[model samples]
Target: MNFEYMKNFMDSLTEWIIPGNSVVIYKDGKKVFEYSSGYSDLEKKIKKTGEEQLYIYSCSKVATVTAALQLYEQGKFLLSDPLYEYLPEFKKMYVKDGDRIKAAENPITIRDLFTMTAGLSYATNTPAFEKARKLTDGKMDTRTVIKCLAEEPLLFEPGARWNYSLCHDVLAVLAEVVSGMRFSEYMKKNIFEPLDMNNSYYHTPNDVIISPQYIYEIQDTKNIVELQQKEHTTGVVKRAYGNELVFGENYDSGGAGIITTVDDYAKFAAALANSGTGLNNNRILSSATVKLMKTNQLNEAQRKTMNWRRLRGYGYGLGVRTLIDKAESGSNSSIGEIGWGGAAGATIIADTEEKVALFYAHHMLNPQEEYYQPRLRNVLYSCL
Candidate 1:
């Protein structure tokens, strides 16, 4: 394995991605690679340690979905179960055709949300979604947001297409209602503590000051300008008020929110890669459930509908995306590799067939500059 390329890739990341941080890679249940560079607090000139937690963004979706699957395994819910059963507000949802809000002939199911085919989009260019945003207005709080979503019409019929929307937010609330506990509490009890992911949480306390997020913005001609050295004030940040924001507020958003460190998250990913075995030989999930979760649930046309890079022939599983074609992925990813990333640039990739897992976390949201997902994946696979 030519690790020189990986080292180069990690070094180059400082120029393109997070200024300084740490990365950890595991193979066959061992830490095969680790690197730390730059500083966690650039202003204070504090070098980044191996233990600082990073905002694991949408990567939290995997944890929330895993909790949902646990409930499913306990016969609390089913894939085919109409989602509206647990969240009745989702019932009577309709679609916007021209000027009218026509009722959807079918109800959106839990499977629809998992498969990204529920016709429920998030911050996308759909008439209904646009209207939904306006309806919710500044009240993006947990209860008001979902109420707005329930009132809005679906963009397409259930199972008609795939779009990355706020489906996970809805999932978070669903987990709460069905499990009879708040979403955060449910995760802490079932997923976090069980897996010893003690460093993971949704919010950062005021006293726990770290360097606020910073990024480069392209200015005139070729000059790149430094954006505001401020914390990201979207989604969870806005709701980080009241009731000690160290834990997430009421915005039970399953898609994003989990905060974790390189070590704790690596253990979680290793468990998924190791057929659900965690610390002390405790199995967080059965091998059967994990296998089922990795299976592709999209068909040919559905696969064609997904337009994102690295997702050409991918399908959504219970939580992770399932790869159906390596050639289409245009990377060295295995046929059965499953994983996803967070909005803040945190990423986790697991190749169950190959028994490998990769975890990287940084805080950059420029989706255009091309992060190290495929590059690192190819490098890791080439090592094998």
Candidate 2:
């Protein structure tokens, strides 16, 4: 339980690499290590502290999946349920053939959304994705988003390939429709309140004013320079396609829209490490459901064709990615460790076998920035 090495590492990291807002590592549902560096608002000289919060972009997907898992345990919905069953707007969906989007051979199901195999996509750099962005009104609500995507063809048939898309946002809306509750309310009642994750929320409340932060843009000469800062008065900003859009009060996105603190998210990661039960003795979900959520759900061929060069055996299950191979991800721990990161530099990985969890939260949007996944895995396991 010695964090001297970790503390030293954090100090060096702040001076060298991305100046982090906060970092914490929980072992067996307990916080043995913690650190906060830099400032939440560089202009106002506001410092980041243990109590301060940050938006954890895609990291919120884990909460969305957790909500879906609770519903699954209660027999509210199955993974195999067709998207059209809950949101009928997806019934007439199709993919672009040549000039026009053609009808798909089969309809997209809830499982496809969970696995990220649904033909829908958010990145519009490619042809199909560009078409998808144009057709969907650039929003992530269930009916409108899916209906807009329905007009455009999927990048590929369902369950055929892996494409990181807006499937999770669609899942969030579907979870609410199936559970008969608002998305944010569902998570608040089931996860946030139960786990005592008080500082986390999907919609930014009026009382809490989110501050602006700077991100470094690397130049061709490898020089890291500071970029612009975005000020927020009320709600969090989520970028899709090329537009920066704000979510409505009722809008809930399953894919990426969660703001939380290091302490609060540590509780979440630790609870999942403890099998759906928090350290405060609250059972947010059943142990069986948590186990099911962490298992590998991707087929052999689909796992191999993913664009993520470092990820080989990783499978998208519920909201987290399961480890299918120890070598590809370079983890020495158990094969069952499942987790993912946000667009901004927020990450959490929970190992069920070792009963350990690690959390890193910052406002940086570098998806490729390397840190505590494979590197921390070796260090954490070596100590054990």
Candidate 3:
């Protein structure tokens, strides 16, 4: 494969857009190509070693879905089963009307959480979270916080459409409840342990130093400029969020909370690409289950809500976006190619059809994904 063009594109990105980026690609469960471009500490001139811990934000959902599916494979729950079956607090949900809220017409199903059709919103500053904070004494544990979320009104009836919300976080609680383990504990024993992903974590270990995170603003109409950490008001220095999505010590944000390195997380991506088996020959899921993981779960009406520009030719899968239309996307990716990106430039590409996996990230927040994601996928396919 000719990876020269892809490498050059990455180098160009480090020069102008974000400070630095790293990528690890695998084919058939073996590392094929790896590169780290630019610097990790731009101020200190420290290069990206491909070992620095990065907060993968929404990319955590990929792992979350994989974890929950293990339970599915074990016959712990069915996709169509009501979420209330596992977490009884959801038995009586409410939906928001114009200025009033009323009980929801339909119950939320496990399928709704996987497909992001649960009608939940990304809003976190509601009274529900506040109540949860008080109840947990600021710990904001998974079960208590998620249960409090049920008191908040949903945007619509469950399963009516797709909405990117805290559904995966609730799925984390599902894993915790059914497996009788904390979300973090369940992931470590099931995912990290099996795949040999030693560096990934739900909390930043005090010993490991994380990469410096940054946020940028538009300098001119077309140029982007970096803001010093002290000058920035939005970014949380070196992490994805402080308490926005990841609540506290006890909370495990399956939706947007994962701290990992490119080299480590790529192993998980490679497992998906290699049909649920790791490079070390550990099988994380059955091949059939991996296929279901990437299959498009959205219908025509539900797809209308996934209007992100970067997802032009894709459909929402269990958690990731699966390629559905090549001509519409102008992409060279395989038909069932699936993956997702983070708010801070982390990207995952899992093409089980071709046995190819790629994980990439730039240590910057508010990653302009629209410009790079589709192009990067298209370029990777061209290299192959």
Best by TM-score: 3
Q: Model 1 — TM-score against the truth? A: 0.84
Q: Write the per-residue lDDT of candidate 1 for residues 33-137, one digit (tens) a residue.
A: 777666666556677665776666678877777787888788888899998898888888798778888889888999777777888766534454445446556
Compared with the true structure, model 2 gives a TM-score of: 0.84
TM-score of each model, in listed order: 0.84, 0.84, 0.94
The model with the greatest lDDT is 3
Q: Which stretches of candidate 2 lie over 4 Å from their true place?
A: 42-46, 98-100, 123-143, 219-249, 371-373
Q: After superposition, how far is residue 131 of candidate 1 from its true place, in Å?
A: 13
- Give the winner by TM-score: 2 or 3: 3
lDDT of each: 0.69, 0.69, 0.87
lDDT score, candidate 2, position 220: 33
Q: Can you tell me which runs of candidate 3 are displaced by over 4 Å?
A: 219-243
